[model samples]
Target: MKLAMKYIILYVNDFDKTMNFYKEILGLPVKMQHDTYVEFDTGATTLSINTRESIKEIIGLEMPASSVASQTFELGFVVEDVVATIEMLRGLDVPIYKEPVTKPWGQTVAYVTDPDGHYIEICSAME
Candidate 1:
């Protein structure tokens, strides 16, 4: 059997801010929207955001209040120019987690923190 990615859901504190970030800031089209959930069109997979309170109610399990350790995963997005993207995001007051750097593999990559504390990787597409 093969697994296919359907959605990457983020449980966030400010649902509205995250929704608008992916919509207007990142330029992702909205596929669907609900009271506490919003899904964005991100090529093959869907990027979804939901309020932490809603997730707790749906799962009926105790969730961690916040993460105090290092980040485990990053939401990566390939763009035309890494420097341009970083500069634009910086103008909008987005937190830059890492400055643009060229990897030995010949790709440029940078990291920015999302509204909900998730790292968003802005990078050059593989050649």
Candidate 2:
């Protein structure tokens, strides 16, 4: 038997805010939504935003808050232009965690945070 990853569920404090952020800002189309869960089509995989309390029930333990101020992981996107993407997200008033800069590996990258504190890194290695 082979195991395949289908989806990644992110614990969010406010489902609506997180959903809208992904839908409007990241441009991920919504696949479905319920009273406690929202799923977005991220091209290759499904990204889910669920209420923290509900996530706790699913994990059978107390879930920690995933806020912009306390992010643990980053959601990454490959873009054509990291600078332009940063400008667009900044125009949307999204908080910038890091300005666009070239990494030691020679990849242009930038970082931003979602409403619930998920870091999103926009990188372009096309150069």
List CA RMSD, all candidates. 1.5, 2.3
> Which candidate leads the pack in lDDT?
1
Instruction: Show model 1 residue runs off by greater than 4 Å.
Output: 67-70
What lDDT would each prediction earn against the true structure? 0.87, 0.83
Model 2 over residues 6-101: C-alpha lDDT tens digits? 888888888778777889888988899887788888867788888889877876778876544455567888988899999999999999989999
lDDT of 1 by residue, 1-127 (tens): 9999899988887777887788888889999988888889999999999887888898876556664313778899999999999999999888899999999999999999888779889999987
The per-residue C-alpha lDDT of model 1 at residue 85 equals 95
Worst 10 residues of 1 by lDDT: 61-70
